[model samples]
Target: MNPRNILVTGGAGFIGASFTHYWLNKFKNDRIIVLDLLTYAGNMSNLSQCYENNRFEFIWGDIGNSDLVESILVKHSIDTIVHFAAESHVDRSILSPDAFIQTNINGTFSLLNAAKKVWIDTPKENNQPVIKHRFHHVSTDEVYGSLLPNEAAFTELTPYSPNSPYSASKAASDHLVRSYLHTYGLQVTTSNCSNNYGSFHFPEKLIPLVITNVLQNKSIPIYGDGKQIRDWLYVDDHALGIELVLNKGKVGETYNIGGNNEWTNIDIVKLICSQIDLKFAENSYLREKYPQAFAALSGDSASLVRFVTDRPGHDKRYAIDASKSESELNYRPTKTFEEGIVMTLDWYLTNDDWWQSIIDGSYLETNSKYMII
Candidate 1:
């Protein structure tokens, strides 16, 4: 099926924005429509460059809005759908599980129902022709629960053992997507990705959060000795993985996307601190004027590390076995952890205003003020 027009949900957020921009360039001939709720995490500015393209359209509405989604299907003739819209921040999910359940679980249900109407009602050209509709759902590796340090990574057939409100909600949605494929004969595929870091990232996330705080001479909070481990994948690579799965992947299958780079909480923070120090203080012109500052910051970068109360239900470790994606979909991560950290650090160092606005009053945690780095 040649999908001339496609609809991408949550295209205004971090990974979503990257996906939207990536796809527009990858498939220049196809038109793309984006739907987002523009919640605290969603910002239209992420996709502002694509706004003027005649092939791109955005609707500022929630996926849970059945009437709105159904209308969009009719208006755009969108045959391919890439679903990324959700309440994604784990911290926020811990604070308010209600919002995550509403958007992640219930919203997915609404999207499936709306698509059934559009795909089922279309008049058939001939009995020999199969339905050309495609539904790609974006998900996370957290749904597989924590892993031991040397444990094997998660695969396509891993059991659902989500530990937090955020993962649990995503688990439910993943089930719904799979059920639709089997029961209603909906064409669907899903990808569970590792931690993503890159440009246009929200401040609440770890990479941006630590980078922002360090720039302001603030303490970098480390939860529970900072021992938790995660596989960090660059957002652009992740965006590419999603497109690969949607395009060449088998229907009714789940794929894992991992960069094969693993780091503990402390190591990631220290790596960013070292990168920032070397880039700004030693590598740049400031080396001449602030040689002492460079030595002090680098030698004692650990001073900024502060062990804070751990998050409730925090997973000790997470890893993804992405061999399926690598072999079948020809997917591979383009960025290493070291290179990705430098890129992330440079972005925060350069773009202060973007993250500063998010760390202001309402979103600021109580510990955000008192820590010293």
Candidate 2:
């Protein structure tokens, strides 16, 4: 019932920014202090609206720095930590696994260590009042690995079977969170979410990549047969799910948050292409602004579809059974995939300057300009 002083790690990134906005707008009394490393994906512009709020503060830093994390926890009297910082891309992980190991594995360990030090051990050693704190880890359904067409959707009890370096690293982090809860009595909960798509999405991901490339008449690459299925969750819905977990979920529990909407890779791309073509037809200015979107102007953005070799160890499918979260926490995704996709496309089309800055590497300049250092 009381206001919470929350620390959001990686709060400038896509989903993290959404959560930060959602919390600040909904909980006027709660103070949000963000600590992010300002990596390539962490853009200050994403949180531009958050700067005006007296309850919001941004600190540019890394989660691996325990001393800094400890200082923030103590200084701000933080009671909840939403951990979203990580090296998240699968392709980047495959090409360079070292960063994944460092950021996802060792970095999570460092964070857990700091939380335990400040929240658990400090009180015991100093005989001070115990701090009421919770650490909520944000994880991916990719940690469940590939699923068969008929296999039951991944549930909270599903054993982790990670296939990619990214998923493996996330699986390790998930274990670390669980271990901390059982072994060290650090109140912790985790949510493994399906693919998230919404505003401020980086252009490299599938949905945003397709939207950006189609607008530029660039090839929309499909891997292998492009039938890999993924359950898509709108980013705002994921934020709401986390809110439920933080407010209602039991400690040491893991929740699966999903949209219950699944689409194949190729189908998702084709859908985007068709939507872009329709948008161009309905709105004449789209074609004028994106003159290079010749395919869309001709009502055939599908012309740009190109099948490419699949990445190594690519998962075949991922689905989530969020029944536990639904029944227990009363969590449900409000947006259907169709509505979410339309909104996503509209966001990208309307906010060219946002993704364009990322594509052209100008976002880094924006970060440096606004970064708190």
- Going through the candidates in the order shown, the clash numbers are 0, 0
lDDT string, candidate 1, 1-373, tens digits: 3647888998878998888888888887898898887777777667779978889987778898888888888789888889999998888899889999999999999999888767764444333444478999999999999998889988978898999999999999999999999998889999999999998899778888777766666778889989999999999899889888877899998999999988898888888777767666455553443344433355455477789999999999999999999999999999888888788776766666567666773423322332221
Q: After superposition, how far is residue 137 of candidate 1 from its true place, in Å?
A: 0.4
Q: Worst 10-residue stretch by lDDT in candidate 2?
A: 364-373
What is the model-wide C-alpha lDDT for candidate 2? 0.94
Runs off by more than 4 Å, candidate 2 = 370-372
**Each model's TM-score, in the order given?**
0.90, 0.99
Stretches off by above 4 angstroms in model 1 are: 1-3, 122-131, 283-301, 361-373
The 0-to-1 C-alpha lDDT of every candidate, in the order given, reads 0.83, 0.94
